[model samples]
Target: MAYLTQPDYVKYICSCGQLKPITSLYFCRHCLKIRCGFCICHEVDSHYCANCLENMPSSEARLKKNRCTSCFDCPSCFHTLSIRATLVQPRQASTEASGDAKVENKQAKKMYYLSCFNCRWTSRDVGIPDQPVASGGWPERTNPFTTRMNQLLEYYKAIALQEKQEKLERERKKFAIRGKYITLTDKTGLTGAMARNIAGLPSTDGGSSSAIANFVASQASEEVEELPEDVYTKEVNLKQITSMAQRLASPEWQPAEVSRLHPLAKLLSVKRSQRCRACDHNLTKPEYNPGSIKFKIELLAYYHVPEVKIISHESMKPGEKAALLVKLTNPTGHEMTIKLLQPEDVPIVEEEEQKSIEKSLEKSLNLEKDSYSWRAICRPASYSALCRVREVTRDFTLAQRDDAAEYDDDARHDADDVIVWRKSNKLALRLEVETEASAASGAPARAALALQYSYRNTVPPAGNQPHQRNHTLYTTVLLDLGHVI
Candidate 1:
């Protein structure tokens, strides 16, 4: 079991050399390897508003600047703003003729405004008119430099396109070979520029050249504006002035005064899926519905990998042996035969299998030879040199997990020195740790161990071949012992 405040006692080594708890690791069924965040690919699946639970397409979200149109955040405290409604008497059409009439006869109208309960801030505080509808009628403030910003954006986009075209042309020239016969288009005087124009695309140089020529650069001014004479002598009112955080919340117009602040549009949240970089197989994918927190596919390591937890350990002294108790739980449904070995004694990947994995990765992901994923797969497991695993020659079998067996009090006790106790699929073992003689006092004590276990492949066979039930796999773990006395 892991605690929030306590440090991790046992950590598994990922394929990419990262040490993480099993809860934070992922198992790729296709690759049959343990992967961490550094060795996987993340992709955004969808965007939605957390407040309204409203989903929007990628194009729509981009157009709206990745913010929810209906939902807003408070400018004062940066909290989600709630819509508040008020009933107000409507103005009389002919107030002069009905001056003697009672105002109670007039009909009342419902109006809505944004309110922040946390900070007690309201839209009326900034002189914003109440909306007739409860949602989505709030007035939007436009940036005064919107036109200039658009021009700058267009100019940069054109420059990027021009650079990309030039790069492609250079690469083509380097790889192209002279042809004896000319194409029909080339013979008919239909150049690439004309073809692009015919396809409704901008001409190669004309569009970018024109944009670059039309761009206007801002000039620096020599004159400086003078501040008010009472600027330093005036008594400051902090309540009226906005703080840096409040002003920066809206980057377009950073309001210096509290009265100039407005409700900010709430940013959109994304639902992303993770995929194994080597196999291109999805590790986890969430449901499309914004309201559902469940995932459609989740291949977490907790379900497939055996979990090892440090139950208790004795204090360690230099060049002395200490007793360690570790609990191992088989999470899989199939019975597993586990053997503990030294970290260095773990078997290396066979040449044939390694070549096959490389080929598969190349076919699936089109990865380069020097890519990070390829390197991680080819690299060997790394462990600290200060720690060594005491060899345990015994092999134990753990029964398949049974949910009903957890309630039973009967636990089969094996008459072995290593096996302490055994339940349904969990067992506790007593192991001895020999500290290095050169280990210094007050230094961290760590022990490295490797597990070779049998795993049952539940996925269906690709062809008409029979199911391959069991396969052997290896994993290494590091245990943190208390500091040496």
Candidate 2:
């Protein structure tokens, strides 16, 4: 078991050469390889409001600027604001009726306003009026530069479209075969104007040209504003002044005083799915419903790969052997045959397989690069030279996992020179760790070992392929022993 406070003593090597704990790695069943977060592609599946748990379409979320219209966050503390209601008694108005004074009692009505439970801030603090109905009745403040910003956006979009059209026209003219006769209708059935109209691009003759001509660029000002003479001498009230976080919470206004701060709309959260970049198979896909915390598909390495835990180890000394006790557990339902080998003994076929996978991925993605750029950038440096794994030339079989066997205390003592004891699906192995003579004192004593295991494929074979249930897979793990003495 991995401990939260302690460092990772054992780390499995990912297919991308990244060393990660088994808990953090993912197994791609289709590719039959280990994958890490750095090598996966993440896609946003859906967006929803965390406060209200209301799911919204991607287009709608984009329209709302990825913020929930109904839910709001407190400007002072940036906490979720709750709607509070209070009864408001109506004031009685007396008028001269038939030269006599009359009094009438009015019924009380409930009014709702936003309040933050964390900071005890309310809409009334900012002089915002309460609404008769709850949800979405609060006023919205519009940016003063909204019109200018929209104009700038349109101008840039038109400029980009104009450039694209010019490039296309140039390429077409260069490749066109001159015809003796000019036909009214093109053979492709899509004229330039018709294509532009279909793409919602402005006509070449007017739309973009007019937008470019009408756009006015802003001029930089040289003048600087002078601060008030009492700015440094004035007694400052820290409570009344808004902090940087509070001001940034409502970025549209960025109010310097706490009284000018307004409640901010809650930002929308997205549910994302992680896919293996090489195989394009989903490793994890969460459910679409915002309220559900479960997943539709979760292919974690913990369920498929064999877990290795360091039980105990002796102190390391240069050019000396130390006793190491490790527990290996088969997480799969089927029994597995495991063989321990030196890290260098593992065949180079695995690297060839990775290259083939990368080729396939590049072909599918139409990418010029051999593989994802992150794989090359994020690979961890190897530390296998610090210590060496002693030769163990025996294979052992681990039984399938049984939940009922966990409660039983009777562990089988089918022990050997390497095997210490055995339980259901688990085996404790006593191994020898040999440190290098040249290893520096106080440096970490690291050893790398490879495991060749038999894995049963649960996924059904696709197409006319033979049903191969069991396949041999190899994985390398690094062990961190104590510093050399």
Best by lDDT: 2
After superposition, which runs of candidate 2 have C-alpha atoms over 4 Å from their true positions? 1-3, 163-191, 194-206, 349-372, 378-381
What is the number of backbone collisions in each predicted candidate, taken in the order shown? 0, 0
lDDT of 1: 0.85
1-485: candidate 1 lDDT, tens digit per residue: 35688888789998766889999999988768888886666778999999999999899999999999999999999999999999998766543444574434677989998899999999999899999998687888889999999999989998998889889768655765556224555446676888898999976688778999999998999999999999999999999999999988998999999899999999999999988876677999999999999998899999998999999998887888888899999998989999998876777655564565466556653345435455565556666545565788989899999999989999878787889999999999999888888999888888998999989888876689877777888999999987888
For candidate 2, the per-residue lDDT at 324 reads 93
Q: What is the lDDT of residue 357 in candidate 1?
A: 47
Residue range with the least summed lDDT across 10 consecutive positions in model 2: 180-189
**TM-score of model 2 (CA atoms):** 0.88
Model 1 scores a TM of 0.88
